[model samples]
Target: MPKALSEHETEAFRERICDCAARLYVEEGPAAVTMRRIATDLGCGTMTPYRYYPNKESIMTAVRTRGMHRFSQVLEDALGSPGDGRTRSRAVRDAYIAFARANTATYRLMFEYPEPHKDDTAYREAHERMLRTVVAHVDVMIDEGRIQADAPIFGHQIWAALHGAVMLEIAGMLPPGFDAASLHTRTVTALIDSARPPAP
Candidate 1:
């Protein structure tokens, strides 16, 4: 039997578990992370995390959902300023990279490491909402005839490319002498170039 977590304890443990998992995932990998390990890392006694989550899978699920929710904010804020779709689109990429950089552990766990497939309705909904928001932006270009009929694919293409670039950069896969900001700018620029129609 596990000790019960109070309201404050729940939130605190939740955040702590996520933080510890993130650090561990980044430093090691998801396989190396355990509920007991997280509790240990956070200086909590064993069985503490179990009170909050049933197991590591649940923790990963929580992390994934939180990652998606955080990503939606990044996408929304990226398009804040008034600009051409191309520029605003880069803002979206920038926001995404920022999120990846700031949340390296979450980003790695969400992408690089593998987790069991679960329906995760909340994760799916948040991810879909993010996609729709971005696709809607691309749809504008499509409706204006600034993009091809397959603009939805273009939207995801840009997102996938950005994710790869951000992941590689964060994972230290990029070669030396390359500035991260420059790489980010190039990724954003390339995606925009490929996705956006030529200027009149």
Candidate 2:
């Protein structure tokens, strides 16, 4: 019998599986992300991946869940940093773009790909954590009297702008001389300024 993997080894292997699966899904489409394909790419027996994930759908979920957790962590770190409301919000914006650029496949997996299991607890929790972090940043601006809009509404608006800019960047749809970072900065600044209370 093959020796059982240690806990650390098991987690390492699982992460490797997720990484491979995400790459395949992005490059070759969903039809290419099969257990046999993953095993072949990893140079393992066809049955090896099944030991870690029960099916293709579960593997896809794990890939998305992992991406969501990492994405949330990036945003949360930016939000937790020492800065005023605008400064921290800018930090969060930078973090979001950096994460998407660095992990393009995973970013697409998390947001663009169809979810394998909408009811998956891990995905839901990670998504909620990300949303809360965003709203909390807006709440900071509200607390500082910098903006006078409902937190959730303003937060969603800001998020939509950021996501739109990022998606365009990913798709190479932005016009020449207009990068995602610059566009995002301008967009976010406008959104925030628009919410400012009128001066007396």
Best by lDDT: 2
Compose the digit string of candidate 2's lDDT tens values, residues 1-200: 98999999999999889989999999999899999999999999999999999999999898888888888888889988897998998888889999999888888888887885878898788778867876678998899999999999999998888889999999999989887778888887888889999998
Every candidate's CA RMSD: 3.6, 1.5
Minimum summed lDDT over a 10-residue window in model 2 is located at 126-135
TM-scores for all predictions:
0.78, 0.93
Candidate 2 — what's its lDDT?
0.89
Could you tell me the TM-score of candidate 1? 0.78
User: Please, what is the whole-model Cα lDDT of each candidate in the order they appear?
Assistant: 0.72, 0.89
Candidate 2 wrongly placed segments (more than 4 Å) = 1-3
